[model samples]
Target: MSVLQPEVNITAGLQYQGSQEKALVGVLCTGTSCSFLYINSVLLFTLRSKPVFCETSRYILLYNLLFADTAHMVTNVLLFLLAALKIIIAYIPCCVLVLLSGFTDIISPLTLAVMSVERYVAVCHPLRHSAIFTTRSTGTAIALVWAYNFIYILVQVFMLLYVLTKIYIDLHLYDFCSKEAIFSAPIFTKFQQTYHVTVFFAASVTIMVSYIGVAIVAKSASTDRASARKALQTLLLHLIQLSLILTSTFFTTIIAAYATVGRLTLIRVYNVCFVCLNILPRCLSALIYGIKDQNIRPVFMKYLFCQGRSSVILNKK
Candidate 1:
């Protein structure tokens, strides 16, 4: 029988900071997941009650976004829990979760871009909005997004598996499997870096163009000021969410690419961004888009009260 020995090179200060940051990030991620799921659940229940809500194209897109974000946050929470508890999930399952998280990361941006386009069309072509973005068409677009993300991620996973055999059955080292690990992986090729850059840039351009088109159309739509205003609010939230996540991703990539980790300052900075900024977007999204939505708020309130009453009864018993 044999045991694989390990080495620990990180200093005590850095280790403390890293653990603290991970714990904070895990707490934030849990909050984001709970809030997002609660609001989406209530909103979904409300949508089910009203046939009109189910029939709207924008609502359909929103539903897809909610689902994608929930999955993304759940994977994040799982990763954080595993790290926090020092639990060694089998290598295969851990890798699968990591891939799922990456897939949703791509899906979030794609969904945001599609949402921006939907708003652009609605604002720019009010008369044709229904004909252009029907319920069926919106559903098909969402399906295509999922299909593309699945195929792309699956291919990348296969490529990585083919190139890096060491990672196949190894234990999940927190320092190695954490956010910083991606940059150091031997199999994280130039092609993968290019893919991320391309996705970010393309999604950014799409969002910008859509926002500009919507603004231009809004300028002339004096009668439809309300719809235009709502669209702008939604777009603003999406942009904020996109900026937060992209900024964290970019900073981590830059640190990994150019900076040396021997410097404690650089490592700490990378850890901070990785833990804090990385998970903030979903939390903000739940607040800005889900909680603040006029239609969803009432349903959420009802759900909250019902839960409160149920808890009170349980406590009394």
Candidate 2:
């Protein structure tokens, strides 16, 4: 493949200093495992329950989000392991991983966008929400989201393959395989930039608009005080999660910008930031949204720890 082809010169790049790379690998491993376990526990609990605790539209979105987040975390672990071990990965596995990672990256924000819309409908059209967002419809929506992401990944892969067939681009430009490495080719860089901007823009607009609408509707009704509060909390969580994800993406991109300078100290700082930002949000999302959810928490406690069910705190509708 073109990525590992002989003509593509591998640069001897200097980045992380002693113990820095090791620390990153360790953090990634621990974070990935922790996230996997937590998410798996929630998933299993949901499965084992005679009737799932929260099977609404919002819960469905959250269920899918958990799986997507786990996949994203796993890809990060693989990338970090390759970087730490100094493995010269071949083109096929590298492309597959990068595509998988990128696909999940986009899916996350999109899933959140859908969740925001679900909240909007629940708040703005409570009577019709049930009619519109039935089990079959919600399942179809989630399937559509995955379908859209798969097409996005295929388009990206097609572009890369076409460009590689025509021109010789080096994979060695990046210490780890990422979609950003495509930026090395001027043609692909435009597509990468355009795609990133489009996704971020669309997701941002959907989230902001939907949440604002939900908040407005919730606050308008005196009886919806509890819902208003939950909306606020949910909005904060989504923003926090988005900030962490965007920070990781840009942190990696910015570090690549300074790659030519190859400053060990700079790389070390970014490595720490990258690992923390990437891992913390995954764990926190599970804690804040999954374990802390009023309905889900009781199920989790009962199933995982044999603890008695706690009172549900939020609006179940």
Candidate 3:
């Protein structure tokens, strides 16, 4: 999983100075994950509760993005907890978790790329936007994104199994389950690096082109200037979000570069990077669309605050 593939020896940081420190770190990580999960769940519910959100192409895409992020976050936190507690599982189960983590990790940026193009169309080709991105078409795009990642993961699985069958190795892991530990073959490592670089490059180009297109439309007098401006802002956010998501693919490589530093310093740096690059990015979708979007804000707040059925009925009336 891209989330678990921090290029450094992850077990090094898992070894805390004391039990108290370990417990504190686990609590902090778990608490943060739980909070984000709650917000994402509520926002997902909000997206589903209304017909407007249901029929809107962008909202459907947003739901897909949030779902992928939530799944990735859950698997990531599970792996972290397992490492922290020194729990060792069988080889097959670890492979399942690792592959699942990788799938969810890769899907977000692809979904963002599609969302960017959707926005570009909305701003630059307003007349065709509705026809171009109906709910069915939006769903098909999402399915294609998922299918692409699924095929990639399926290839990795076949390669891993082939390697295992040819080699003499223990069925149980000697260390914490991670991509590096499980898929340790030189070929697997090289393939993953190449794949991540390719995907990141492609997503980057898609988003940049979309941003430039929207910016051009915003400057044109014939365009809906207000809508174009809003899209430009949204695309800018997508770029930031994309950078954060893709940065995680290199978390291990970045940390490994500094591996020669003192143990205490490295631990601190690893913890900070893990939280910033891995955990926090998964929650930004909720913050960006759940809170920032005007259309979703009222309904989101009503559910978030536990407004009663009476309030909803009154508002609808």
Model 1 lDDT per residue over 76-172, tens place: 7677666556676555566678788878877777888898998988887878989989988998999999998888788877776665675553455
TM-score of 3: 0.89
Candidate 3, overall lDDT?
0.86
- Candidate 1: where is the Cα deviation over 4 Å? 1-49, 165-189, 221-223, 254-275, 305-317
Query: Least accurate stretch of 10 residues (summed lDDT) in model 2?
Result: 308-317
Please, what is the whole-model Cα lDDT of each candidate in the order they appear?
A: 0.69, 0.69, 0.86
Model 1 scores worst on lDDT over the 10 consecutive residues at 1-10
Clashes of each: 0, 0, 2
Instruction: List model 2 lDDT by residue over 212-275, tens digit each.
Output: 7877776674537787678767876786687677666665567667767755556565557556
Q: Best TM-score goes to which candidate?
A: 3
Q: Number of the top candidate by lDDT?
A: 3
Ranking by TM-score: 3, 2, 1
Better of 2 and 3 by TM-score: 3
* Pairs that collide, model 3: 6-252, 7-252
